[model samples]
Target: INIIIQNQTMIAQMPHAADLNDVMSAIEAMRIQEESSYQCPDYLSKSEEDGSALPVNEECRRKMAEWCYQVVDYCKFSRETVAIAMSLIDRYLASNQGREALANRKLFQLAAMTSLYSAVKVHEPEAMEPKTIAGLSRGAYNEDQVTAMELEVLGAIGWRMNPPTPLAFVHHCLALLPDGSMSMSDREAILEIAKFQTELAVHDYSFVHIDASKIALAAV
Candidate 1:
């Protein structure tokens, strides 16, 4: 209930819808730039021979994703933080060919913590300290281990931390909705629900293969 109330307050305090046009334009520019600069590596469905095999199978992947959802919620991090962390984990796993090195549960936990730490640094103003993040792991990792994993993740992804996420596309589309198409109260309600749906979609591995724009549209 507190979470819902907090979300409502945040949404109410968001900039006026008119500013969405500028946000949309900026996101579109980012999309173009990202496409030109980096190609999203095949991570989930790639053949084993491609050196991009999923370290965990489908069932394990689902469990890992659920764990991520719980951790993010417990920490009260923004939804965007979870999305960014998930992206980092996916990209790192996809690009690296060594499945044996990451097959252990401890290493995966470290990766998740490091990814969350990195995402928090980028997206949150009051960043979560390395120790706090380590504590969340129940001593599976220490502060030094978390910091080390952070550097490893950064190197693995080539320092590309700002990849476009579904929430970005969703915001862009919501901004494009026709003005006065609905009552102000109705619009706010729809936006809240759509945003909720988008957050849920992020945790579902099935949606990982879908395009961000498509997911955003479906959510809205």
Candidate 2:
């Protein structure tokens, strides 16, 4: 209850257009300046090279990603949450090399749920309970398992959950658009379309190797 109230308060206090413009401008500038440094290696392609050992193939990844999207939608979480969860899953798999434990179907499901749970905690003030997350997994994972995997994933990623997602870059680029290029309504319409495209990009395995900023621009 308190957490929900806090979230609502935060939303209510969001900055107006003028302040948002300034913040987005700064983000856009920083993104451009550090674009080269932000290149995440082709983790998906590398994972495929060791596919015989990893067990989780492209089809498995696609199913889990779809499940994550469904869970996020059912829970009314933002698309950003799903994107972050996908990012963590990819990074964890890539960083751990041939950890055969992830090959287990049950363990893989738990990892997916845990990644979503972690993203929720970071991106939502009022997070779903561990039991709720486990329930959504259709009993493949219990609350305790979900809790444990959450810690494991956090450690695996070295607690770096703040990767720059395509959505972030999209907003930054949208802010950088010329002021007189379009009316406010037109700009909002473009943002809506871009965001929808970004959501599609998030689940597609083909886009996994692409840079986030490039994906953002492409979506726009």
Candidate 3:
């Protein structure tokens, strides 16, 4: 009994690894589609409680966020890329009944990866040439891993790539906001905020189940 107590204490004192149940619950909360319209607030609360961990360490979060912004800025990707990716993942899962070819894994990563793959295909076709896509997920696992899974994703969802993105909306809204109203830096800041909203949408099934045309509007 004493030894067991010590072991439990040590485990608890160690860094908090992600709680699997909590993550799944959060994932469930983010799921947008339901046969029923009603949802349990308790379920969402529980997931939120579990998913409270910082996505990265404090110092790293800012750095990572900045890096992501730079990439977006450099690439000149419209916010639509993020929205399109989100919708693609949601559509793929609903179409497949949330089943990927590979079983026994979190649907979240698979969805994120697939959405990203689809976005790359449409938005950055030249940069995301077959070779590049293959390289991104290579060696980490069998090239066949993401490949087979991606194929399954494609099969589950028909080729419907032309989704409106938040960037499109941002442009539209900004244009109508009044010319010369905001500085370039201010415009980028607004865009950044929209991007964050897009990411939050990606986390839940809301992106998947919502209309693509409305995705940008909702996200922004």
Candidate 4:
């Protein structure tokens, strides 16, 4: 059964920025959540209700995480690319109830497809083709299902074609580093580090409130 959201109040306008107090609260929350003791809620945690469907289980989560990093390493995606992919997954999970349809694996396929789509749009717009996305979905899900998920993702994000992403912060931090004095190898190393840290941050919901800029800076 779908969880009923009660007394939902809709906001008409989006805030462009946070005030100083809001920023301090967000920073403190992030710090508190950064502790090693923190554990992520299982994507597939089951409810006590008799008919409730579980989200992705631990095994699936592990496999999904593995596949995500594989895509990053294989594609040689920049830190920003990895971050955008992750943001896509997190956003979908937050807003979509695909998990409730656990009799099938559509939601799992949706997650993978959306992550790939988001990454491509951000890092390699030239490389991303409609056919490519469709093909990826065709491999694991019905073309119609994938199309629906894509639409769902787009709508949930409010059709914002250019969302600010972690890579934006990563770039800003890199500029503050040595003036191109760093070796190519060092830069690549930083890229890998930033990407890994961004994925690790996904486990903490508090990380969501922290700007990607700070994460990139602290990672450096």
Name the runs in model 4 displaced over 4 angstroms: 1-53, 57-62, 72-79, 96-105, 129-138, 177-192, 202-210
The pairs that clash in candidate 1 are none
Order the numbered candidates by lDDT, best leading: 2, 1, 4, 3
Q: Write the per-residue lDDT of candidate 2 for residues 82-118, one digit (tens) a residue.
A: 8888877766765673254456666776787788887
Each candidate's root-mean-square deviation in Å?
5.8, 4.0, 18.2, 10.4
Candidate 1 per-residue C-alpha lDDT over 1-220 given as tens digits, one digit per residue, 9 for 90 to 100: 0011111212112334677767667667756744643334445566445564345655565566677677767777666777778777766765663244346556776786678777767765556778877788887778888877888777888888776676777666666677888887987787788778877876776766566667777888
Q: Ten residues in a row with the worst lDDT in model 2? A: 4-13
- Weakest ten-residue segment in model 1 by summed lDDT: 1-10
Candidate 4 lDDT over residue span 183-207, tens digit each: 8688769867875676676434456
lDDT of each: 0.66, 0.69, 0.43, 0.51
Report the error of model 1 at residue 126, Å.
Answer: 1.0
Give the count of colliding residue pairs in each prediction: 0, 0, 4, 1
Please list all clashing residue pairs in model 4, or write none if there are none: 44-55
Q: What is candidate 3's lDDT per residue for 87-123, written digit by digit as tens?
A: 5554554443443311323344544455555555556
Off by over 4 Å in 2: 1-25, 28-40, 48-51
Candidate with the greatest TM-score versus the true structure? 2
Reference-based TM-score, model 3: 0.49
**TM-score, cand. 4:** 0.56
Segments of candidate 3 deviating more than 4 angstroms: 1-82, 100-103, 106-114, 129-141, 144-147, 180-188, 204-220
